[model samples]
Target: MKTCNNCGAQVEDVAKFCPECGFKFGSIAEPRAVVTDMYDHTSEFSPEDIANNKLYAILMYCVSLMGIIIGLLAAGDSPYVRFHIKQSLKLFICEVILGLITGALFWTVIVGIVGGIAIVVLAVVDIICLVNACKGLAKEPPIVCKIGFLK
Candidate 1:
């Protein structure tokens, strides 16, 4: 038997995850063990990596405007870029659908006004995520997006 580092529960030595806290038993403690204050995993990125990969970072930010094409390109190597690209693709698709629906419902000043407002909000969020990406920060966008389908 071995004591789990996470919750101090006794578990079999052969167990992979702790029974009490589900912490992985052996390979290495989760990053949470070292960086306990933050809840987001993106925070684990090293600053040096972000600074050196500015091009990839910018590509991820611009993915919102280019849609799936750019997103697919960005997903090639860098996991950081891939994460942002996936998120931006989701937001872009949602915005497009919303634009179509609103245009159909109210093809006048009202839809334009509301849709424009929504676009601005999304743009600002994209900008923020982009800036964070540049800084090598693992920050997700404020917008709710689904990238589960992306590999």
Candidate 2:
């Protein structure tokens, strides 16, 4: 078995992506071809793989924004898990920015409504992500896969 670089999980040699991390098996230390055409973005997740990592995927959504760290340090043993975690990571960044904005808004009680709205919006987003993860879907929100900076 080959070890996955992202989650350090052992994977079969014939696998392309890590069963836990979704990262290309052999390219652990190497950067991924993140900019490949959408048509070429094939990381077929088998039902067995999805079944194996479902819990990790759900944890990625339920653990607040820290789920991203959990994904990096622990989960991410499957492509489906990695996809959701990456999306959650991007959302966490947005959450941080929104939090800073919300903190500023708190000074003005009237305008602080925006903070509440942001909270609600993030919660809804989180729920949606959680559902998808539970389904073992590797489908990503637009921005998650679009950001090619991540190797």
lDDT of each: 0.65, 0.69
lDDT of 2 by residue, 42-106 (tens): 25777887787777778878995566667666755667667666677776776777788888778
Per-residue lDDT over 1-151 for candidate 1, one digit per residue giving the tens place of the 0 to 100 score: 9889888999998899997889887656544555543324466555555555556656656655664455456545656556666666666666787778677866688887888787788778778867876666765566543233432
lDDT of 2: 0.69
TM-score of candidate 2 on Cα atoms, chains taken together: 0.57
State in Å the error of residue 23, model 2. 48
Off by over 4 Å in 2: 1-43, 109-111, 141-151
Clash pairs (backbone) in predicted model 2:
19-77, 19-78, 20-76, 20-77, 20-78, 21-76, 21-77, 21-78, 22-79
